[model samples]
Target: MTRNIWTFITCGLLFSAAAVHAQSADIIISKGTDKTTIDASPFGASDPAGRMFIQVLTADLVRSGWFARGAQGASEYILSGSAGGGGGFVAQCRVAARGRSGTVFDRSYRGDANEVRRLAHEAADDILKALTGRDGMASARIALVGTLSGHKELYMADADGQGLVQLTGHKSVSITPSWHPDGDRLYYTSYAKGFPAIYELNLRGGSIDRVANYAGLNTGGVVSPDGRWMAMILSRDGNPELYVRRMPNGDPVRLTSTRRSAEASPTWSPDSRQIAFVSDMSGRPQVYVVGREGGQPRRLTLRGSENVSPDWGPNGLIAYSSRIGGRYQVCVLDPRSGDVKQITAPDADYEDPSWAPDSRHIAATRSIAYRSSVYLLDTLGDPPVALIDQKGDWTAPAWSPGR
Candidate 1:
């Protein structure tokens, strides 16, 4: 009898261990689709007075919008980070919802003392993606052309519409500013040469260099995330067609073949593997995506009469302006599942929907009731918030990736 009881107890212990292991595996597998409820608090890492790491981590997490910041009550998740001695810091996070622990997401990183802020953001992003299966957008910036005082010039602003600064001093119209992957420079179409031309403007030096000059039209340019190639629309070949050019040296390589369709408003995928742009190949202007290396093109937009200004975000989501219900409105598309969601209704001619760095918000110019203004719509939120009020017209608002 004693031997039998001991055997039973051992078997029960083994079963419990196996169950725990299985639960852990399930959590790991389902993490990508799970939305975690979390709380962030200070974990004992260094001196009590040292909270710089926590500050930076919280800022980064808030900017990412992956989690709803907890106030005081019970939180679904908890995050804590500290910069301790020995030039190393530890960021530990726990996610819990209702009564279940989501996952054990933690990391310890070591780097130069001056890189603490960058490291902090990186650590926060890792924790966020590990727990929530989404990357943080705290380190991205946006480039767009803002019109002021009857002059259209290039302007760079933060993703939240703050810190607006004019990038180009040209009196002519400048539009379609694309940022290099490093966020150190901007390439835009400036009319300084009597026609739309590509110009590379250094953000650090406030210097501008002409990149591509064509006779007919050169506009709607975008740079690859790797900064190796550029995609733009150039009418130099008699009509607007997609063209790819090598950066810094400005070696041109035409990507499209026919003048049957006007290809413009090119936006690159986050991985730099594909390019999405507006084309009239399907008898009308619609959004189409093609491989970067040149191949067959696939149409994405079909429900709308006309769709233009496609902007690809971090995830597989694409934002564009569509003529729905007799007016131009902003719409979003899930490229993976073919799910289309109309964001802006038929009240105004809303165009140029630029995705925020977080991939959760879109910045666009909306014209309603004979007035135009800049608006920021948090796709994950209930609705959008007006960021700027304009009297005449505020068009082409781009959210900066980050500083």
Candidate 2:
């Protein structure tokens, strides 16, 4: 979307200054040849706000969890993009540490002005990928709750936890902002009028539409990759049970027929042909996967008090958050072999694990010192590191598909 003038000013006065200062700081790479010192070279564009725009772009890049902090300072390969005068064409620019001066990578695109930010993001993603031979995080978004005036609301933030945009400002509790495969809209649960219901909020139109309204419970809704259906938990059938509903029109196709055990946290497999959900049918909450057509379910995790929010990763891996030793932490499992591996050893409760679109990083919400925040855990790295600090309570982190 075309950023408001106020948004520009806020970025200029706040994050821009930080970016300039951060440029002087060192950039660390867990897996790299060596750290390089480069600059966020100047950009000449018709738009007078190019500096501030670049700062905001840098901030966006750093927040993706792919780039190191103070990126502008250590960017041996400088890159830039700008919106033109008519707001129609975006002039792209880049300079790499090729030999003398640098090698330049430049391009232009004729599109909507709102695409300016997207173009910048695309440029950053390209640069990062070319450098590391791995994917970047610029294309991700964060899902959290935004409370105002004692009302709990739903929000979607940039991957860095900035650009906090409220998706639902209902005068009630609205939590669990999940993303569709397209990333243009958000699916969340809201208690706007007292009863909890699932709603879809469109980011472009700022409109909220109810997706499901059952008699007892309607929560933990996650859409499949094909965008054809949503796997959620509902109590309309009598007790809390897992259900799959067609999108656009809430026509639920019950997946589980059990009434004795409560089932929730239904996550879809990457192929969209199966669903991994949590069921107490085994006496406690455990991870189980069943075919979309409904058949025999194979249990996954066998440790901890309860294993919830089982998200299927890109490959043959399933990640879930389980309460271990009275504290919740994230763990990974091989659905076929039933092999389990603990990824997060956080001293506090760490729940709601959302796998990054790259399948390399897992973002989760952890409770520390009575407050909650989001942490990014690298599957191949050391441990989980907090991404969003103790500023505000953040939960229900749903990573957007690579944009």
Which candidate leads the pack in lDDT? Answer: 2
Clash counts for all predictions: 15, 1
Provide the lDDT at 170 for model 1: 86
Worst 10 residues of 1 by lDDT: 23-32
Misplaced by over 4 Å in model 2 are: 1-49, 53-91, 97-104, 108-119, 382-391
lDDT of 1 by residue, 77-129 (tens): 66654555454444443434435555466577666655555566666767767
* Model 2 per-residue lDDT tens digits across residues 1-403: 1223332343334334335433221211223123333356555566744443466556645544455433554555565445464645455566565344745555554556655555566666666666666676665777777443356677666665656666666888888878888888888888886799999888878888888887989998888989998988889978898788777676787888777888888888888999998898889888888898898787776555688877787665888887765778777777765555555554678788888866677888888787887778766543456665434677778888876
User: Local error of candidate 1 at 76, Å?
Assistant: 5.9
Off by over 4 Å in 1: 1-134, 389-392
CA lDDT of every candidate: 0.68, 0.69
Weakest ten-residue segment in model 2 by summed lDDT: 23-32
TM-score of 1: 0.69
> What is every candidate's alpha-carbon RMSD to the true fold?
13.6, 11.3
